[model samples]
Target: MRVNQAALDVIPEARPPGRARPLAALRHRNYRLYWTGQCISVIGTWMQSVAQAWLVLELTDSAFLLGLVGAAQFAPILLFSLIGGVIADRVPKQRLIILTQSLMMVLALILGILVVTKTVRYEHVVVLAFLMGSLNAVDMPARQSFIIELVGKDDLMNGIALHASLFNAARVVGPALAGLLIARFGLAVCFLINAASYVPVVVQLLRIRLREPRPATGGAVWRDIAGGLRYIR
Candidate 1:
């Protein structure tokens, strides 16, 4: 069915000439729920990042190990990001996100419990960092695809920019909060709080009523990757 062009015309552009209006996407109910939940979740994710880095430093007392920890956390993206894009295209993005988010929660909870019990070691941190990074490899694409589904084509650019803004805003707040909690209470608190933050996003994912259309199936992975590359080239 064709969407109404008149209605499209009526929808305001997210950015006006001089004055800035942040949170314009929050005007839509689904996007609003998604925005708020993601805001909280991103902050928690950043908090965990800061806590994890500090925890690694505490254990190893080496900048190299800290860098290693960071690399392990993102290594999966370098290895599997293209595959993740394929999976995101083939699967229901929302369902993929829910699964990944749940896995992240579990990882955070495990780390939190380990720290609280004084049983966490550098090895455990390395393993968990890799696991979380693997999950993120898939989760990031699912999330990017899901935003397009939430706002549709016309507002997609606005949606992506808004999402980036939310991420940067959280980046500023999450680490500071994590540092405070780490200094006062301990790393366990940061991990536990990060685990708790996933709940709202999971709930919001479950609540979204729209059904995203599935991508066409029956392509080999390498062929699909090549096709994407060729298209871009």
Candidate 2:
């Protein structure tokens, strides 16, 4: 995909100018539905992230502890993403995302209930963070790979760009909304709302009719990891 082909350095010259247009990728119904659902879900995800941070501060009140919590959330991604990528290659991407998203929704609901009932402990927050991060490790790679299936090679570049734009827009706006909601209704409401936001994405996932994917050919996680490294070398 020639994203920002005009950028300085490397590869082919810029598109002879005026080739790019706005929202060209939205023409595909599947991409549109997927993108819209993802937008809603991503915004809610950001909201929960902000609310979770606030909850951590309230519970611990230490910047170091807060940093530790953040690290705990991403540690799984750092440690498991390579193996997760191998797992993604062996499963249907849509099915993988559906299962991971379901897990995430359940985790969010649990946290919300804990917070609302005044039973949330710091340990609970850390443990849930770790669990959610574990899901994200697998979900992230598959989600990226699945984009081409939605828009195909023709619109692949545009689809990828639009996805990034949606994510950044949500990141900017979601935190502000989270702050307001937390100020008024509190963290539990934010988590609960995020859980609800997953509904649209799940609905879209089920609506998608995927042809049978090619079976993944590989044996053993370590062998796959070694093959990946050898390819890089």
Candidate 3:
């Protein structure tokens, strides 16, 4: 049987709604690359988290110190996350993410080297944990906002849900793997692995073809901040 070319072209475009389909956002080539790279990097981030917590326990043998370390690593989120969203609105999110990810890589390497050299102290861990947390405070907003540029408004919700799924999945696998690595090797290896994981994400960010959206204007920084505050209120 012969088919009409025009009919064939029309049929593929008329996809049925409410049908179970592969997440449409993943269809974008750039987004697929970005998502894969992020997944790998997030898993490494979780692994490093587990390793760091374990290292604190090993060094101080105190649960209080471990709690302190975790708090130090997360406190900035409470303090700076709103400011971070403002920065993300003002900057190129992709470039900002690349910068923050690179910083994280360097911090991971520093911790890894200190541990491997047997020169790492509890204070060093605390300082590095705070540094990492500060970087994350900035990174999270930029990374979250970058997704809109990749897939646009049409797929934003699907992308976010998929991204959350990947994050939680990593949360599970990363800590389990870290536990194994810490038992067989050492905490330093986990940090080193985390550093290596960032490499692919950086490379992927560089390769992604995105037209960085222009920053909003017509308002002072304080005005914009106040506007956001009022909106939330």
Give me the runs in candidate 1 sitting further than 4 Å from their true place. Answer: 1-24
User: Considering summed lDDT, which 10 consecutive residues are worst modelled in model 2?
Assistant: 5-14
Model 2 regions more than 4 Å off: 1-18, 230-233
lDDT minimum window of 10 residues, candidate 3 = 5-14
Tell me how candidate 3 scores on lDDT.
0.84
Candidate 3, position 227, lDDT: 80
Report model 3's TM-score to 2 decimal places: 0.90
All models, RMSD in angstroms: 4.0, 7.1, 5.6
- Which pairs in model 2 have colliding backbones? none
Model 1, poorest ten-residue lDDT window? 4-13
In terms of TM-score, which candidate is strongest?
3
Better of 1 and 3 by lDDT: 1
Each model's backbone clash number: 0, 0, 0
TM-score of each: 0.88, 0.89, 0.90
RMSD of 1: 4.0
Please provide, for model 3 over 1-233, each residue's C-alpha lDDT reduced to its tens digit, 9 standing for 90 to 100.
Answer: 88643233212223478764457778666677789998889999999999888888889999999999889989997788778888888888878899999999999999999999999999999999999998889899888887777777667777788899999999999999999998899889999999999999999888777653576655677777778789989
